[model samples]
Target: MCFRKKLWSIVLSAALVLGTAIMPANMIFAASDNESQLQAMAVKSGTLQYGDSFKWTLDSKGTLKITGKGFLYLSLDDLGDIKNDIKKVVIGSGAKEIHFSFWSFSGDASLPKLAEISIPLTTKVLSGSLRECENLSVVTGGKNVEDIQGRVFEGTKWCQSTEHVVLGKTYIAYNGTGKNVVVPEGTVAVSEAAFQSNKTIEAVTLPVSVKKIGSYAFKDCSSLKKIHGGSSVTLIDYDAFLRTPWLDSLNETTMLGKVLMKYKATAKDYTVSEKVTQIYEGAFSKCDNLESVTIKGKITEIPRRAFENCTSLKKITMPNTVTNIAYGAFDHCSALAKISLPSRLKKIETGAFIFCRSLQNVQVNGGKTNTKLQSIEDAAFAGCNNLKTLTIPWGVTTIGDYAYGYTDGGGDENSERDMVQKMMWGDEESVPKLNAANIIGISQSLGHYYAKENGIKFTATKKGSALKKPTVMINNSGELSISKVVGATGYEVYDKSPYDKHWCKAGTVKAPVRKYMTYELKGYKYKVRAYRETSTGGYQYSAFSKIKTTK
Candidate 1:
């Protein structure tokens, strides 16, 4: 299915190029009356390339024609030489995004001769692609564009003449002088910095169709006191309402629709409401007074810098619904001591828990077969000097560089000197060694590979080895009997009632005693596993036996 989509995209691009090439020569020349002057200049007509995917053509008539199937990459250097001669830009179909490089010098227009542009319906995002085109006046097409990022039409003649510049379903740039504004219906997005630095605007009302509010959308709107109709919004980018009176007026915990946007309360402990389905980046950042946080909602990911710099934070509890912990989610959380990862978590991004000086115990719940964790990215647990041991899950495949047991050497002079030398001369031995003394995981797993590669001692647990699954039976006296396999020092019994969410530890029996008293309640299930004492005094357990229900 994926291959077919790629083939279709390639075929469509070729057709777009062919369509543009077949335009009659007379039609191209008929647009200008000074044909003799155009011919005398000997303007070069060839392909201009940006990146690997985009290619454009400039004709002798000063017409720039853009043809592509994907993103549009524009740079000052790419068009700086011929920018003065290009008067018109015609974007052909199949271009999905447009990005323009910032001006070479502040307040200087790059394309002085550019007067008109035509965007295709395939373009969805226009990220300041035409900004600083001082002479640009006419804009055609782009009736389907969804996002207009960062003052896209700023300083253009077209934007200066229009009060509320909107392209398709996105509210682009706003130039209105009114103190209050109401976005029209059917608009789905308010682009980045759409109303940036507008001091007079005291209130703004959005239609229900708007789903995304871009970064710095209302930044520095000092007089803005109310933002109505945010119940349908699902995504709010970083600092969308920063430095605004509306944001200052909000309560400690600000919820825009289902997303938790900010947490400003000074309380020592806080629990997120269960209704929150998502958390914005830096939602609770720099909260030095916060000691503990409990997330009990349907959020699927912890965004970047969600709780960064919360030095007093010692503990955090998250529900199992979370899958990904983004980069720097818990960075510099010095007081964090322990955390229990969700069973369904898939990836821990780079620097997810970096500089967590007090972090010690990281518990990965669920059995080997149930946990879905896959990768531990670079610096995930770096600077955690107190962490002594970690048990990587069996499902994890990759352990990134410095994912665990790396310190930044804050107070120690020798370690700081070593760090500086390592950076200057690339001295490998000058770098501090892994802080974790012991690492445990299944044999031959990535955990074992990391330990071997780092010269750390590893304790590997062989699956179904001497500590095989114990034989569990219910005797006539209502007691559970377990027949253990060879080389077992003890047996651990677990049971779960029908209403329980997870199995609970029943009891532990030594090698000679294989029987355990059964629970009095009916409809309870039991399972037993054999464990052997390791050389380091840690217990290695075999897989649980087949479950047996009590009558």
Candidate 2:
């Protein structure tokens, strides 16, 4: 994935440079002989002038034709005095999108003569371009349109006659006066603001085919108390059910299908249920009363700002299934003191734990042997003044700027003062250098580079040993003997067979008794490394010796 991204960036850079060299400045499309003949019969003809992509020609019959590739940029002001003269609009097949400067074609002013529009099959989204055009009655060739946002045709003749406006598989708008509403089958998506601000809607039933509910889909429906039939829904945008009685009625936890939408309760302690597989962004944000949370599920990520401003939250337990800690997931959780990351965690996004002043400890990979962590983005642990030391794993290749203990006066004066008090109170030994924290990891790792670059104190966990590598000898009887090294406390034996993908630990032999034997030694390669016990009860290892096999 990284290689592909780099390759795509290079290709885009080269394409941009080549395009700049070949394209002329202030260039406009020159009309061909056929186009010139067609323009002669037109009432008006001009380029969009914003870009060379679009051109417009209004015929004598009051038909406005738009030809464009990529996008059609239009506005009521773009028409100038000819706004009232347009009766029909035909968009070219090459146009994939239409962007209007204003929300709609007719807003303060009216396009009374505009009655018909023909969108091409290539256009996939219609976003409030012809809304409130009261005279617009006919629409054609929008079979490929998949998304419709805002009130695209609120006052139009086509929308006034229909209660439920569905385009393609998308439910675009609700114009019904009924209290109980049932969305038709085969509808796959509910567009943004589809049922917004409708006071009479008391109940809504979605079809099994509906997979997504856009933001503000059912917002401000005061009387809406029930929503049924969302078994097939996989995605529900934030605030999809905002300001509705149904959402307010959900006490404690609000869940829509497999997604946890909100935590409404004032409880001091909470645990996410295992049934929920996903969590929406900011689900528990600003929950000041929440003190402890235990997440139990197959959730792969903690969404952005999921627990921001949880001032009382001090503890959080995450399951091993979580692999990503998204950007600002725990921002300003001032009381959070310690966190244990999961073994499968890969990346810690920017500002994930920023301004958590009380944070003192962070254990990565759950203190396990192997880690899959790759990167720790900028300011991941910034403003964590209380964090004295952090141990980075060897597998991590990138340690971003200010990922460790860093303090600033960016509206966090109280935290900075607390750190200063600790330093002045003769407890300075527990506090790390200002803006530079103590880091512990294997020698020559990225953690060392980060520490050296930031003037932080670094301690190598696996330092080079003075003891020489132990020699491994295998005889015909498959008895392997490892020659002992001076000043070594023990030797670790590793073996790799033809079928093995990695070297496996065979056994460890104490010093002065280094002779070792294994039954499955035949057709297997073996190596040995000597280690000396450190004062901290850890081992410092020498480089592995040459591989040996039984004759």
- Which one wins on TM-score? 1
lDDT of 1: 0.78
Off by over 4 Å in 2: 1-40, 43-55, 68-84, 94-96, 103-107, 110-112, 128-138, 150-161, 252-254, 263-278, 285-305, 309-332, 337-355, 360-551
Top lDDT prediction, candidate number: 1
Summing lDDT over every window of 10 consecutive residues in candidate 1, give the lowest-scoring window: 22-31
* 1-551: candidate 2 lDDT, tens digit per residue: 69999987876577578754544443323445547655556678777855337888898678999998886777765776677788898988977766653334335436668888888888876775556467888877877776665557666787665788877777878888999999988888898888989999999998888878888889999999998887777677656777899877766677776788779887899989988877887889999999999998888899889999999999999998888899999998999999999988989998899888889889986664247776788778877778888888766645665577566544466755664455335342444445546888866455665676567898887754456767888877787787878878888787878766446678888887877786654578888877766554334456678898755
With a 3 Å backbone cut-off (N, CA, C), the pairs that clash in candidate 2 are: none
Evaluated against the true structure, the overall lDDT of model 2 is 0.76
**What is the TM-score of candidate 2?**
0.51
Taking the tens digit of each residue's C-alpha lDDT, what string does model 1 give over 1-551? 69999987776577568863644465344446556656755645445466437667787767888776887877777787788888898989988988877375767778888898898989888884566788999888998888777777877898777789888889877888899899989898998888999988988999988888988889899899988886778778777888887776666788777788789988999998898878988888899999999998888899889999999999899999999999999988989998889888989998898778788888777434336787888768867778788778756745776677556666354664555445345344545765546777776455765777667778766642345668889866669988857878888788889886446677889888888998757888998877765553334456678898888
lDDT of model 1, residue 510? 89
